[model samples]
Target: MTPPVASLWRRLLDWWPRIARILTLAVSIVVVVLLVKLGRGIDWREVFLAARGISGPTLWAAGALALSGYAAYSGIDYLARRFLNHAQTIWKTLAIAAASYAFNVNFGVLLGSVGVRLRLYRTLGLRHAATAGVVLFGSVTNWLGYCWMGGIFFFGAVPRTLAAWGIRPEATRAAGAVLLLVACAYMFLCATAARRRWTFRGHPLAFPSVWMALAQSGLAVVSWNIVALILYLLLERQVSYPDVLGITLLSSVAALVAHVPGGLGVTEVVFVDALSGQLGAHEVLGAVLMYRVLYQWVPLCVALPGYLAVELRARHASCGAGGHDLPEEPYER
Candidate 1:
């Protein structure tokens, strides 16, 4: 209210974004350091042996599910392309999406998902801001689903491991209530916000329709469930799906917050702790190892070549590199 205080407040507002990034980077460094220390405490030989104990059939099944999960991920971008009315073929959209997601999981967002998508989408005719819009849409859509699923599961069936951390069911349920409220608010905005748009830096993105919002949430929830199912199957269903799903979702938070690639060691540590009551450390680590192979590495291996090939083809094709391939409507400012 005072002029001096208001000036100070304005300066703080201007500096907040930088302050947040620095804080986030510091936190990620701490998390990664802790993860490294925790990782050293494990007996990797036992983890490897436990992986060897897995049956071939289960491995094959997990592989199949991984494919399905990746396909669903690509579907997110397909929705984005449609939302943007971008004139691109389905196969190309899928290729870019799949490759970007694969990178995103294996690398961090900037290095993998966002970077890969921006590069390939540019080759496919999207401008920088247009690609940013697509990336923003994909990001928002995923989190909406996460909120929906997290709120439902946390409220309905608190993770068994929460008790270990002295976290009360009531607390998680309260958190779930909050998450659900956020999801509902997004839905309400989609329905009534009337062509609302968000701008960060110079890139502006429009909100999807209510139906598209629901579709995004539905697809994302399924994709996330399939991820949990992969781990469950690898563990031979020894752990309850809700418990497994709860841990899986929680791990995503750690990785996302820390900006770790594919969550790397973060996921293994979280799973081991959450399921310690039901399984040995080795068993959990083994399932996680198999999960990394099937879900992350294999996709990365395939995607790398696919990405190079797409880039090569795009370079040879008669089109402006990094220029719009199609006439895109102006985004609402």
Candidate 2:
């Protein structure tokens, strides 16, 4: 090949990943814009009135709860490290946590937590395989919490409510049956992995004590539920906590099933539909959108600069420049 042609080909190869990221970002931006536009002509006055009705105390209390949720989220990795017996520091974990969440919210599964972990693995001194294992176990733990929270309402509340809503009891029963089978399959996989003594680079999975794990998961669900309630309170005058919790939990589960990026329209639709009898369509939509913006984007906005700082420092250190010494390998799966 000619020298110029070969040089151009190498340059393209090097730029490919960056190009792909840019494309993904562009698509996400377009999706958000389209969804917002689709739900236009919203009554701003009602939204503003609802916002005004949200008591100052409630807002403050909700904010505090939301912050606690963030703490719990950061602790996910902390517990994972403790369980895995990795000697990683908290600061590194904090940065990776921020990056992973920001990426997951914006980019969905393609650039989910796994991607964030992969990018920050160097600082953690983990290889790809080890990092994958860490991410997998963390994901499983997180999902267990999600299921635990959903099951509470699903069994105790959803079934009764669905019947009241005129949904056939047999339909709910069928759904439960399907979910049971799925859960069994998942448990089988985890058990199989456990039996194999699978470890990324032999870093044994230290399963967190069941009680502690349950507590962590429970706190996570409550924190998130508070976030959801805050949105409803800000956008509607009358919504009981139990109602909000039930609606939020069920809708969240459904949105996950739809698998849309950040569950975008899917979540909003579910919220509005569930609350239709009590809330005007526009009011619910507005409330959900506002909450989505605040809960979903605000944290990432706060974390972005910190993540960038970490990345820059890691790069400089690796080049033997101004950055501090840090490991380059990531955990293996």
Candidate 3:
């Protein structure tokens, strides 16, 4: 409580945001380097041949699965809105959710997704608190679903994958147990502390009801599974579904931890490392490339124009209304 100590703490708090940004940038660079090193051995000729050999029907199926996956992901936003008791048409929510996710997958969540969501929600007339609530709810739901599915998959169905990764079966099970425990803890909190609110650094945090959490988790699981299915279809179903599921889960976790843009190289590196023996490196690389185009690039192409149109309309409205722009709101640090 002394003046000198208080001054030191205040200075540290002021520098925290800059420090965090620096750390994130450094980590992203490291991940990109690792990805390049991991991909050095891949044969592009084979990769291209594999891509070219993919049947039209298979490509169509993968595209359909990709669409379904994004649609399921949009449900996260819908559930978040419900949790916050915000009223918006499902169509509008879906539009924002799809566009934001497309941006997030390409540009990273912190830089693009959150900003897009905040702006879109504000333009839709929600206050800052509601926007933050929606973002928090969506993030929690994603983690909850990941833990639930990952715990189940790693604990029982994919011991071979653990062995391949040089992880002992016992250790893998223990890790799985830890994941399950974290998910269970969240559910317990929701059940018993639904009305509880906590303040952290001047921001209020609230828990959704148990049923809402369950719904959120379910939707996330569906979205993730659909994504796995897309990859499986792209690979011509050569690999077993369980193996694909495990690999997808590992890659997803790695990309999330790396915080790299679009998880670009992180995912491909993990996939190649994990499934090299099960499938040819070039074939796997090709399938991954195709999957990215459908899931990330295609969505991004659609989202960018939609976002611009929205911005243009907003600008025109502001100009018409006495030529003043809307006030900018500060996003959560």
Q: Pick the lDDT winner.
A: 1
Q: Give the TM-score of candidate 3.
A: 0.85
> What is candidate 3's CA lDDT for residue 179?
86
RMSD of 3: 5.4
Which residue pairs in model 3 clash with each other? none
Residue-level lDDT of model 2, residues 1-333, one tens digit each, is 699998998899999988867765665565466457546855667766655555666566656655665666667777666666554577777567656766676557557577767667655566656566568766766666555555554544443335546777556555555544544444554546544554544666434454545555665566556655676566554666666766676655555544577777766665665666777776676566556555667777876787677678777777885445664544332
RMSD of each: 4.3, 10.6, 5.4
lDDT digits (tens) for residues 81-138 of candidate 1: 7888776677888888889988988898887768899988877766677687788888
What tens-digit string does per-residue lDDT give for candidate 3 at 105-165?
Answer: 7888885558998888788666788787878777788778889888987777544655787
Model 3 CA deviation exceeding 4 Å by range? 1-39, 194-204, 325-333
Any idea what lDDT model 2 has?
0.62
Clashes of each: 1, 14, 0
Candidates 2 and 3 compared by lDDT, better number: 3
**Considering only N, C-alpha and C atoms within 3 Å, which residue pairs clash in candidate 1?**
125-325
lDDT, candidate 2, at 148: 53
Provide the lDDT at 3 for model 2.
Answer: 100
